[model samples]
Target chain A: MQTVAHAVIAAAGLGSRLGLGRPKCLVEVAGKPILEYQFDLLAQVPDVRLVVGYMEHEVIDTAFQLRRDITIVRNPAFRTTTTQQSYWLGGLHIEEPCLYLDGDIIFERRTFQTFLSCAEANAPLIGITEAKTEQAVFVAAEPDPRTGFLAVTGFSRTDRSLWEWANIACLPAGLLKENGGDVFTRLSRHLPLRAQPVECFEVDTEADLELAKAYVTRLHGAGTQVAAA
Target chain B: MKPNTAFCFDLDGTVTRREVLPIIAAELGLAEEIGFLTQMTIKGQIPFEMSFRLRCRLLAEIDVATVAKIVEQVPVDPAIAAFLGEHREQCFLVTGNLDVWIARLAARLGCRVFSSTAVVRSDGRLGPLTSVLRKSTPIRELRGQYDRVVVIGEGQNDMPMFEEADIGVAYGGVHAPAREVIENSEYVVAKGETLCRLLLTL
Candidate 1:
């Protein structure tokens, strides 16, 4: 399987709805901060650029503690701009194909492994899951007639039948460079989007955090049971 | 001077609250040496052209990618954004820093930049300095076009510009303007907001 060596994590949002008084990535989940798990999984990726705002100093401190060579980009106008802008800013330093992850996401390492191991190495791949939530980015997909692989038709905010976007994707450097004001919207139209099934969720509110914790705990318990059996 | 004046700003201390070269040097673990050289140059103990070339030579082996990442994090004065927004076309970033290092920053500010140029090697590392900027050149160039050229700076490097400009403001927002810069200027402003108000009256 082909492996990418760069990743861009957009963690610049204020996370006001999370009500954490700090950036959501710093919020502890299970035993460690949410971004810690992400760093552990992405340790092999040599270049990791973290776009930070809101509590930038704290985030940079945490990120440096996790990895000494991590590159940090600050979006000073983060209060006025969207996550897309932060993504663009962080992507500036990355020159190779990269995995783009949202800061508020919590998922098993296998989810990323699955996406990386998938056969769609050349094209952009967006992770999608059967799991649904009130605040999920819905992705429309159809089975490819030739290869039986699921091909992404479009993305929407209010599509009930569509699977939820898992907030993780492997994007080509060219696509990242071409990103403008509305990145995701433009990307869906420009790239030949492929879908990878992964078990993942985004954390936005207190209830979402609880959901993430419970999901992780359940996965851990299931692993323990299998080990004992 | 009327509203049709050209505004030239010194990048390191005047426009940005921090000295960019020392920050870059500190990131590369050469802060003490570079910092001393920078202070000596600014204090007029060493000539700028000589200090600048020596600094670039020390930075020659550093990868352009690493420098770009570090430069991206260098903080700019917050009030300068609004000030530039109000007078976009007239604002110019005049810095002695290499073009290879400050390109992204200048592009982000969306202003014309008069900066030193560095030779980028085939391997993507910074090479020798091709051009050393003299601030007076840009100030004199602006004078030909505008009725009044208002220059704001805080370093001895800006002394030539202060002599060439029609109106000079010694800015001490980050630290006190150098003695020679302060002596040559007509007004001195220490705060960003106050500087903006002073510019309005110009």
Candidate 2:
């Protein structure tokens, strides 16, 4: 059983690189807003906060239309601040253990479920993947001797072969409250960090969005085949 | 040397013993629904702007006189009033509540007020909202005038002001200040007297 009761989705970015007129979360992946898929996966988590900016009204409207009870926190300075700041703003409402996911991600349901189930015991779970890309944030980690959990040591951009952060993780609320700066930076500073491998991709550029769409299409096709079988 | 300090207070919870809107709602017999919405807003489940507009619409039919009466009965922290009295020139009531509804309280407090403005129709009902005060805007303005801007607030809406101010004090007099506010604040004072004393030290 997952201990975390809250989930914080950092969706305040303008995603200027993606060149999407709206926020990245509002962009559709499989004929539906990307956030709708996120909301669907996070449905079990009782308290969910969507930190919105850059066409926030549309995001809020869409979010409410999807789930009436999901909380919305606005990072008014989203234009000037970083994703870390938006996460901090949304982090305020999170009381229990929480699963924090970046807004731009589109992943298989199994990917998140794996992270959640694996993260309940090893808190401050940093979701990492060997699937490195141009934007991959390489993490330095070592496996724990006692529990065999990967303890994160450092984060760097220079290394390409190392496991990279998937921008999805479950963290204890206490650890979150004590930290400042970017979530990745803060996690790196705090030792004994647990790492979990998950299959997820972030949609940063137009190319990334296309990749997400393709991935979602493949997922739908696979689901359809399973049903037919 | 004493720094030129300006005290910016979030009105609803930090200064008052209870939230004004829910109190007014209770008086108007819409407490259950309004109170739920208020809780939702405070919990960050709903955007403050959306919740504020919905609450205002719910209270639209309510006469100004009745609101005034309810406002009169609303309990403000005595310690806050005392603190403001000692430093009236440097203190300001910065609230998202309407100027018209809070005018009497502002006058009674005798401090400069920065609040949302509302238009009143000829029949005395609130018309369309003219301006919804974003707490950070005034805090930013105050930063230009004061050497040190100290913001004291308890809600999610107050987080912006806290971000803008030089010193953010999360007061938990009515209830525990929201976690985000507390995390961002320089000082966390749970009691009204302690909050007043903390202000003096700063």
Candidate 3:
């Protein structure tokens, strides 16, 4: 069982790029909202918070139906803020290690479970994936001598790398700053963080949504193989 | 420096387990009629102040002693009651509920009350509306006394305080907050124990 007590989903973005005129978490991938998959995976986390702003009632209503126990932290300033700020607000007053992630993600169950195990084992861990988004923040990494597992060295949008940030991390609440520009930018300040492979798909744009559909289809087709390799 | 924060709470459906108005209406067998209006007001179809005025008029015929007796029995979350009791000096009940109807409930909760004031008539029934609280007045006053004022509520009427206070927490322990309240709030908490835990830490 994961020891982390809190999980916060930063779902307050306008997702203007997707142009659905709704919160991205409400955008259905196959037949369900992106939040359902996240809720299913977060069964063990005792405290869950969704930072909602853009079209929040839809998210809150859906949350009431899907998972009612989780807390709903509102970020009314979605128009002017980024995910970093939303995560900060959601994680506010949370003193323990928190599992923080983007709302628009579909992570393979087994891979995500492994990532959770690693999260508890490592302090201030970052989730990485196989460099596969449309506008990927490529992660530069090298093998850790102790475990031979990849550890993030640096992050860049222009630089090419084998792995990218999966928009997930298990971090102390104090590490997240109010003015933290982007989640990645804030994480960049404390570099050389431990990295663990978590097979996931992020839906950001119209094109990426199609790729996510394929990713979900792959997950359905093969239970174990479609996940972290 | 962390400011001396004051925790101001709304009464109906927030501290009290149910909406006090509808419960009072039940005394006169207008529960269904007033309950429908309450639901409508919560959904933002009927305006809160207008609905409140109309409900108060409908309920004005009931004896003030009887209304007080009914509200005295309304269930409250013990965890929240304990939280208020522990911080009575820094806590307040800022409600749009009439003082005559909910004053006893507020006193029981150990909160310095800021509610719409009213008086008993010659016949022992509540008189015409004396004042309808704007809800923001007390929050504005508290801001002068404290570095940060935190507002906790779950209704449409609570939006003014949410906007005025330094920090707004939409409490959904009893019911999901009005959409406008959530929009104005900086944080929305779902459970009373969790809310208390958060308040203790903050």
| Candidate with maximal lDDT | 3
The interface root-mean-square deviations, each candidate in sequence, come to: 17.6, 13.1, 2.0
Per-prediction DockQ scores? 0.03, 0.04, 0.50
Query: Candidate 1: where is the Cα deviation over 4 Å?
Result: A119-121, A177-182, A224-229, B1-202
For each candidate in the order shown, give its overall lDDT on alpha carbons: 0.77, 0.77, 0.84
Runs off by more than 4 Å, candidate 2:
A174-180, A224-229, B1-202
CAPRI band for model 2: incorrect
Candidate 2: residue A219 lDDT (0-100): 67
Candidate 3 chain A lowest-lDDT run of ten: A220-229
TM-score of each: 0.54, 0.54, 0.87
lDDT of 2 by residue, A83-139 (tens): 777777666634557788898887667756777887774457888877545577888
Best by TM-score: 3
**Pairs of residues at least 3 apart in sequence or in different chains that clash in candidate 2:** none
- Candidate 2 lDDT, tens digit per residue, B61-126? 877766866786788899888888879889999999988788888888889999988888889988
Question: What fraction of the genuine interface contacts, i.e. the true contacts, does candidate 2 reproduce?
Answer: 0.00
For candidate 3, write residues B1-202 as lDDT tens digits: 1338999988888888887877778777999879887888868798888888888887888899888888988999888899899888899999888888886787788779998878789999988788889988998888889888988998778888988988888888888787778878777777787678667757
